[model samples]
Target: MSKRVLDVGNCGPDFSSIKAFLTKNFDCTLDQAHGMEDSLAALREGNFDLVLINRKLDRDYSDGIEILREIKADAVLKDIPVMLITNHAEHQDAAMELGAKRGFGKLEFGNPETLEKLQPILG
Candidate 1:
């Protein structure tokens, strides 16, 4: 089955890596969100299989965490699997504590670990 993914953050190499990986492996569509507002709008407007939020967005890194919290708290959005993307382990823990499905390290985007970590969500 096809899937929908909402990718929230600035356009960067990490985003590229993720897009490439998803395109090559899954029959999915991507909706890009450049900031928290856009991310929230996308979540409300569409049903996504997964959400990938950057540890930091166009304005600030901490904004992503706030976005994560909002997603988890929303009755409708809470069901979507959310992953926080960052290279920092500390940030990952914070995201997890906020109810993120998983913390994804941007550095691991091109590695096999990315695929492994994404398996459950993708499946």
Candidate 2:
């Protein structure tokens, strides 16, 4: 079965790279959302196996943590696995503290460790 992923707040090039990497490595499909409202709406309407939220939205420079928080707080959406895409350990820790899975940065997109982290979810 192909998994479905919602990628939130990523810019065009980033989303393209992510989509390519995921498609090449796993049986999955990726969808994009530019900000919190869009992300939440997509999550509510779709069956996504995982969510990848950018640390700062390219669209408005809004904090992606707020989006993560929203998802984690909702009863129905809270169970869906979420990962914050960032290079900063502090930000990663913050997301993890709020129930997000450890996410990889854009710089680490093609790393083996990233594949390892995603395997259980997307494999």
Per-residue lDDT tens digits of candidate 1, residues 76-104?
88988898888888888888888886666
**lDDT score of residue 113 within candidate 2:** 97
Model 2 regions lying over 4 Å from their true place: none
Candidates' C-alpha lDDT:
0.81, 0.95
The CA-based lDDT of model 2 is what? 0.95
Candidate 1 residue runs with Cα over 4 Å from true position? 59-62
TM-scores for the candidates = 0.88, 0.98
User: Model 2: clashing residue pairs?
Assistant: none
lDDT of 1 at 49: 92
